[model samples]
Target: MSTLTDRLIYIVGPLKLQNALMASFLERETGAKCLAVEKFHDIQNMDNENTGQPKLALWDCLGNDMESCLSEFEPDFKEVLNHSAVAFFNVSPDLGIEAEFIARGVQGFFYEHDRIERFPQGICAIFNGELWFSRKIMNEAMKKDKKQTGLQTRYETDLSHREIEILAMIAGGASNKMIAEKLYISPHTVKTHLYNIFKKINVTNRLQAALWAAKNLS
Candidate 1:
């Protein structure tokens, strides 16, 4: 397994002091260079000394209003995911939102209630190509898989070839306009297909439909 020294780690948060403090701690713990980034976009600005080094971002999701924080964070998600293996820190311990983040391609999570000592090991684990979800979440996911095995097959079978193609594009973070252009179809036609895809898969939005495609299509 590769050590964290082979990559760069960014501690991203709204608060500069917090980001810096976390970055310092990680540097000491992992013997790897860590950077403090107040904004996710800031990661793009900094030039990487080693272009081949893997990048990991520990995003601080701690706030009284998590909904607002998350909503604000979503827009930059695709961009950041393209450049880094992103993980959430200072998250609520409930594990209720783990599935949503997983669908959005987050690499791992560290709850606020988690012991500080555990952070290094968890971060190391993530760098070792392991996901850092709670055991409870893993068990729940396993249960869901078993229960939905037949339903997933049905959903897969019900999708048209074009719809399947569109779903795959959606999972790849393509917008409706992009998909339409690539497929040589109108945006309105794309919307119609999306509506049908959502209905057939029992999802209400593009995110859910994308997640469904990720699990069921491939």
Candidate 2:
């Protein structure tokens, strides 16, 4: 396995708003176990003397009083950021405000006003090594160059048809080879598809993915 797969991800911000949402989403949505610290210094201090470091640190970029927070946090911020892939969340509009955070240290910025649907999409994108910007902002950036795009419906990105079938087979006690034969594909293909399905549904194993499919999709 790669070091990234073994590494944890940390989220730092206020307890109630920015940090909690990301912490909950990461724990449930990704394979990594995430640790959340309220302060940047606490996270840096913990990592310095620890056995290993987190894969990434997602900081709430623009907090109460940006100038004051930056002046107070510059030192610890640089240290924590140096260890992990740093991402920022603005949560409010005003691209200028988000830009300021990006300039400070964040590699990516997520809008706070996006529907909860986009939050996971953004995190997953960042986890895979890409920047997640507000499609709203993107729309503005590309407006003159592009044509109209259809708005994505809520259920559109949920699951694939084959994934649903595999999940059902899993719930029905079908082994990988059995699923392979049933689907007229090789066992290797079945395993690969299963892994992708698990990633989509945010589960690590067949049973959990199956249960989620049964309860939510079926």
Candidate 3:
């Protein structure tokens, strides 16, 4: 698999020195070339026609008005989402922008106070085509999913007790490995149970299953 350093990275924010330092650190840590731009318009003016590789954009939201910054960059955000992936750094837990960004296809989010050492791991996960949100954000998403699916009753769906237990864990933002460990089951067994759970509940992904659990199990 290609590492994150193999791709171009753009750090978007208003702080020039801080952004430059961040870019330097990322390059030193990952051996990846990075560009620090103060405005989205700078990115728009760059020539990227030669490299067809998907780029990564990290929006630094520390010490600024999150809502105002996001609103100002909404057009640029959409443009970046068209051909590349976007992630947020220095985010607050209660910023309440996760859902909107998720809806806009954001790939990752890191809390403002999170350790900088985890940046490489998060970036790698995003490069590997996975969502890298904080556990709090995931739990909030689960709650939202659950509330949206709350009209359905348990009696309406004949899910087994084990299935319900697993679904509840899923809604709580537990990974398959975590669930398997907690439930004293093999990962394979968890997968099987999830498949059955999805089929029974007529849902496809973890988000949907979480919603189903919220509606019926809660």
What TM-score, over all chains together, does every model reach?
0.62, 0.51, 0.63
| All candidates in order of lDDT, best leading | 1, 3, 2
Q: How many pairs of residues collide in each model?
A: 0, 1, 0
- For residue 151, model 2's alpha carbon misses the true position, in angstroms, by 41
Q: Candidate 3: where is the Cα deviation over 4 Å?
A: 47-50, 145-218
- What lDDT score goes with residue 184 in model 2? 99
TM-score of 2: 0.51
Give the residue spans of candidate 1 off by over 4 A.
1-3, 47-50, 64-66, 139-150, 154-218
Give the per-residue lDDT of model 2 (tens digit) for 47-88. 865546446676665554556646645868767755766766
Runs in model 2 lying further than 4 Å from the true structure: 1-5, 16-21, 49-54, 61-65, 134-218
lDDT at 158, model 2: 60
Q: Tell me each candidate's RMSD, in Å, in order.
A: 11.9, 13.6, 5.8
Largest TM-score belongs to which candidate? Answer: 3
Single out the weakest 10-residue window by summed lDDT for candidate 2. 144-153
